[model samples]
Target: MNLSIDVTNNEGVSNVVLTGEVDAFTAPKLKDTLLPLTKEKGQVVEVDFQDVNYMDSTGLGVFISALKSTKEHASTMRLVHMQDRVYRLFKITGLTEIINIESTVQGGM
Candidate 1:
């Protein structure tokens, strides 16, 4: 299925809710939605992956680029509520070591 992204801003944080598969086809859409947020200094961009069932290497690359962009802007990017399969992808790729991931909503909120 195609990917869907929902974005909401709360205070200074941007909450991005992602659903469906994130592959090469949909990864660009994710980047377009997120890359701009990373340009806003002091902005906190939170990606909630609770509904995302699949993500490929392309999607992972998008997140890595966003992480770099956010850091350059002195902002932060958080990955939240990742499914077990998706989380394992990050773990295996060693992205978990570089990216900020919050398993609990409390930490994200």
Candidate 2:
């Protein structure tokens, strides 16, 4: 499976829309697209996961890295509109405590 990323920035807000599977093979691409957006100060990165049905630990690693970058650079990162199964990974790993994740929409890709 492949991951597709679309990004847009407006008034310091970066919106990232993700589609397809986010596994080991596609995590690097997601990292590449999202990391840079979080490297700037005062940037707010909003990642929409509505169409992201599947995600592996590698994808979590990417988000972790991005989250770290956002913190180091004085930025913020958010994950929204996630599917229940995909959101479970973060919850199971206890990332929900440290990361900003919301909108667990019921359904799949």
Candidate 3:
């Protein structure tokens, strides 16, 4: 499947809305679009994963890299509105503890 990433920046925050899958084939695209935003000092990079229903380890790598970059640049990365199935990957991989993840669903965080 293909991956589509839409990014907008405002008030020192970069909002990324992702659509489609993030597997091996699409991870590079995500990395390209997200990592650059993390380079800005004290910036906030918020990614909406509500429309993304599928992802693999490669996608995790992209986020991990972005996280590391954010730390180096003093930026913040937030992943929000993720589907349960995709969120489980982060949970099982122990990333939920390190990454800031939130959901719009009631009782979710």
Candidate 4:
């Protein structure tokens, strides 16, 4: 399926829900949606990957860039509700150590 991104801002946080595959083509769209949010100071960006089926290296790059942008702005970015397959990708890549992942809805990143 093609990638789809849904964004919502509430209580100083930007919640991004991603559906479908994230590859080189779709990563750019994710980046564009996240870049401006990350630039906002004190804004917490939560990426929900519950609906995502697959992601490639370019997708990973988008998250990394968002993380960096958040840090630079004194904001934060988090991954939420990742599927096991996608979670494994980050774990194997050592991104789990650097990025916050919330496995449960109540789990704080």
Candidate number with greatest lDDT: 3
What is the per-residue lDDT of model 2 for residues 1-109, given as tens digits with 9 covering 90 to 100?
8888999889999999999999999998999899999999999999999899999999999999998898899999999998888989999999999999996645543
Which candidate, 2 or 4, would have the higher lDDT against the true structure?
2
Clash number for candidate 4: 0
Better of 1 and 4 by lDDT: 1
Q: Can you write out model 3's per-residue Cα lDDT over 7-108, one digit (the tens) per residue?
A: 998999999999999999999989989999999999999999999999999999999999899999999999999998899999999999999999558565
lDDT of 4: 0.88
Residue 21, model 2, lDDT:
97
Q: Write the per-residue lDDT of candidate 4 for residues 1-109, one digit (tens) a residue.
A: 4898899999999999999999988888889998999998899999999898799988899989988888899999899988777888888999999999965444444
lDDT of each: 0.91, 0.92, 0.93, 0.88
Residue 3 lDDT, candidate 1, scale 0-100: 93
Better of 2 and 4 by TM-score: 2
Which parts of model 1 are misplaced by more than 4 Å? 104-109
- Cα TM-score per model: 0.92, 0.94, 0.95, 0.91
Order of the predicted models by TM-score, top scorer first: 3, 2, 1, 4
Cα miss at 105, model 4 (Å)?
Answer: 9.2
Error of 4 at 93 (Å): 1.0
Point out the higher-scoring one by TM-score: 1 or 2.
Answer: 2
- Candidate 4 structure, TM-score to reference: 0.91
Looking at candidate 3, what is the lDDT of residue 17?
A: 99
Worst 10 residues of 4 by lDDT: 100-109
